[model samples]
Target: MAQRSPLDLPEGDPFGPDNLPYGVFTTSDAPHLRKIGVRYGAHVLDAGAAAATAASPHAELLGASSLNPLMAAGRPVWQAVRAELRDWLTNPAHRHAIEPLMHPLTTLALHLPIEVADYVDFFASEHHASNAGKIFRPDGDALTPNWKHMPIGYHGRAGTVLVSGSPIVRPHGQRLPPAEAPASPAPASAAPTPAAPSPSASSAPPRPVFGPSLRLDFEAEVAFVVGAPSPLNTPLPLAGFHDHVFGVCLLNDWSARDIQSWEYRPLGPFLGKSFATSLAAWITPLDALAAARTAPPARDVPPLPYLDDAAAEPGGFDLRIEVAVNGHTVSRPPFSAMYWTAAQQLAHLTVNGASLRTGDVFASGTVSGPRPDELGCLLELTWGGRDPLHLPHGTRTFLEDGDEVTLTAWAPGPDGVRIGMGEVTGHVVPAAS
Candidate 1:
């Protein structure tokens, strides 16, 4: 595995022989069918097909359309298959038999790799959290009272989880009307903008208006796919993060800011967040990302005993996450700036005696850094819409219709090697009336 092998992958390509990220793909020739495939440079090895002809017992797991069955088998099976694939692709003795199973990746279609059992999103980046507080709650502390003590998160709608190329429908919902609007509203032709505010304004609260969201936004995030399930009343310690987390992928947690602000007073987000989420196709195993591991930023407040393990394992990834809207690069947020680690989030998710099922997805919320240019979402970058973001083609206070947002990431693989986490991209369409 160390030296260059028989595979024709470019030396510097992220998906080289040493990095065989797995995904579910199908060629145009067999559009209706999907088979498990492992990437090797520009090609995808039909693992299921290779296993069948190679007389490997793991063929059934490798050949399956989805990775769920293999995930449930736990770590040993995952390690074994990875080793086998590496050997089969590199060994001279096996190349002749494995060549026919490899297909150019460009000719295939990638689909959702697993059935999402649950989805949790965490506000783990201190920079992002601080900016959110300053922008959304100017009078309150940047970090909440309980924020440092726990990894704050909310359960997102798992059913709305979509694959990479899915279309994002701009959500329609209720927003508070201006406090200065007259008691009697004029017709659309008569008046489009709200009437000029009188010197003396009403003390009453504004009424709610229903329509498409005016403040649609995107959050660039990194999500991990849980590989195995944990029993009820049991918790996974910090040390078991990589053990239970099979792999990582790019995630775009789409949001409707106006709708979310109106509804998230007592309880957390519901429709504003539940509409849709996008994920990348490939799940690059955590094992393949050994070179990316690094020590996370020093914590300002130590967490409780259950979630704290300073001497444990490396907790941060050196991944560079970039956000693109309509082919314009908006930000390059730093994932390593996160104040909380994936281990902590996993521990807190199950600390309440909740069970974790295979395919559970959890994301490290918007990975904004300390710099203004490092902001991860429009809410932060635009400073709650007070300042508009200047783009190459145009300006955006928030996302406009036809805006295509994409999130992509890369991390240090093995020494000088780099691995691609793939991209989760979606185009925004006008909201349905």
Candidate 2:
């Protein structure tokens, strides 16, 4: 009896013919040479080789070392290439030519799929933002004034965006000391007490001290990859989202909560967030997730005309995400719970005439839901460290050296199948001296 083919996957495999995510990989025999590959069940097909074997017109695009060139080719080309690849895999006539190009996934080393141009992260989840505001400012409003009016985002350091499995060096930075307790109220002896004098320089609040961050955390997010470039000073509307975006992937936006808390006032995130961000190697194409599209949550405030997506296609993805630490599942953030949709984010990002690049990446900030188990990051799960999470290994308020965090997700796919977004994982190492 002959052994079953790797392509003959079990029913309902997340990575089926309906979901052919792309990535870059290398083999031990030629570690220096990188090639674009498409995942198929337990194997990765050398896409370029298969295209070359089939004498495909898009062979050059498929054969590139990086996904940038193909992604820059625009939407029509993307659809055509995807159609051809699917036909080659599903059609028995091309199986003989394609099967030889399939390589075992375990034997390959995956790499960053694209050359990142610019990275932006958005605070898109209402639950997450509310939780954060409540944790950091107990006496203030949970959501900011302009939060519902538009998508709040900040530019991130693209150079630090790394592929999954990379080691994260805990960042070093200044952190404010714990707040001093209020002095007991003086006895009500005087009818009217004079106001205390303003604090002098010598009596100023405690100064920040430099050290390794004590509150390391991970934010589970989903990100979109840009495909086509746009002209400078031209705005892309919400309807143009699919025209420019190529695919989606899982993202782990690593953060130093202590460093952020000390420096985030007045200005937004700086060194605390610029250290490291992990991206999954596999990028599931937008076309593969057609079944996952769903209506976004109803907005409490009416959106501005430019960001309005009321008449657009369902702008939210029904992705179910799982966040784990050291092999223990902790949170299950639902992508569908995000208050702001990806289309709205794209429109808001380009509304000011900012251009789009082929490899530009923008992530949905910390996907979280209303349930206790649905929080995306340690900052919320541990409730600002007041409540420690009791994992099987031990209790944890935040990440420790050698701790590994992984994020994985799946969306509904065509014909009741599931579309896998793969996973982004990183291990924390001690900070540098």
Candidate 3:
């Protein structure tokens, strides 16, 4: 069936002609092999066939099961593929041959777009940082001394990067009990032995526990993917950020507050964060986000010389990110409100001459706004477990077993149009025995 006219799409069609994102997919007919495709109205166009029909040399590159080959081809090939993909969807002459190649998203499965070479998560949001300082260390100043000087980030575990819809097993780790709670918690796996009936035996306090995390949480964030590689000792200037970065997507850096607070005191995140990180499949090219760019929030302290270049334009994206738990809307974080821009983060990352690989993935720290409801995670929204959030089902201090969390986002396009970032969702199940 050929598309007779301009395809009549839904009111808020995510894959309209203007927003053609790329990802790997597998259909019911071809479950064994994966193929790359560009998104359209409720359908995915075979990028390989589209490239072949356009008589482009990149056709063979697009036929690969992964986007890494095309990504390594750099700016020129990426631009050409984007142009050809848009033409195939809009050009009426190619309708009949192309229609058969397109597959509905409902009948297909989307996988991770790029095989991540490395992973990093940053603490770039001042609002989020301020809240943390106040909640954890109310006596000292909220802003740390060197926080304004540069972007703060740490390397994360890339081996555990999972695609959307994957089950997130509730991680079990050692955690400290609250001050007011029992002195010690019984072992999770061991059955409690009966103590003496004497008064002293009954009054003895319990010991610390090892069980599933009591304060599991979710962080709503945005991350950028590196398509163009850079050599060691060759820093990426702020002006050349777009040249190195291929595109942006949504990320969920799941957290366990109890494990983090106890372990992050001397260093940074460990088992608390490395257990799992979720990402959306589609990779929205930077060129398609022209209208979504905006200026970074006002800076109280100017950045270092190499991190900010005056010639480079303001570069924050106007993407609205949302977090939902079990189908109920809880927090709506404004991605545009981030204090540090993606370019600044990219420049700071490589300022020390760290070379970038083809599929390096780094995330913007949790996005939070000035409003109370703008908080990105339960730790902030509930004031470090001081205030419990009241939901339709019940009140929640932290994520409970069986709760599912999802992160989704959208950006502005031309003529009142909007583009979407495919959602990343994961369900929390019981921890290991």
Q: After superposition, how far is residue 70 of candidate 3 from its true place, in Å?
A: 1.3
Looking at model 2, the pairs that clash are none
lDDT of 2 by residue, 21-45 (tens): 9999999999989999999998999
Models 1 onward score TM values of 0.92, 0.95, 0.91
The model with the greatest TM-score is 2
Model 2, runs deviating above 4 Å: 178-202
Model 1, span 4-61: residue lDDT tens: 4336676698887667888999888889798998988878899998888878879999
Model 2 residue 339 CA deviation (Å) reads 0.6
Writing each residue's lDDT as its tens digit, candidate 3 over 134-204 gives 76556667767877888888888998888888888888887776752322221100111222234465575
RMSD after CA superposition, every candidate: 6.3, 6.0, 6.5
- Using alpha carbons, what is the TM-score of model 3? 0.91
- The CA lDDT at 55 in model 3 is 81
Provide the lDDT at 342 for model 2: 91
Choose 2 or 3, whichever is better by TM-score: 2
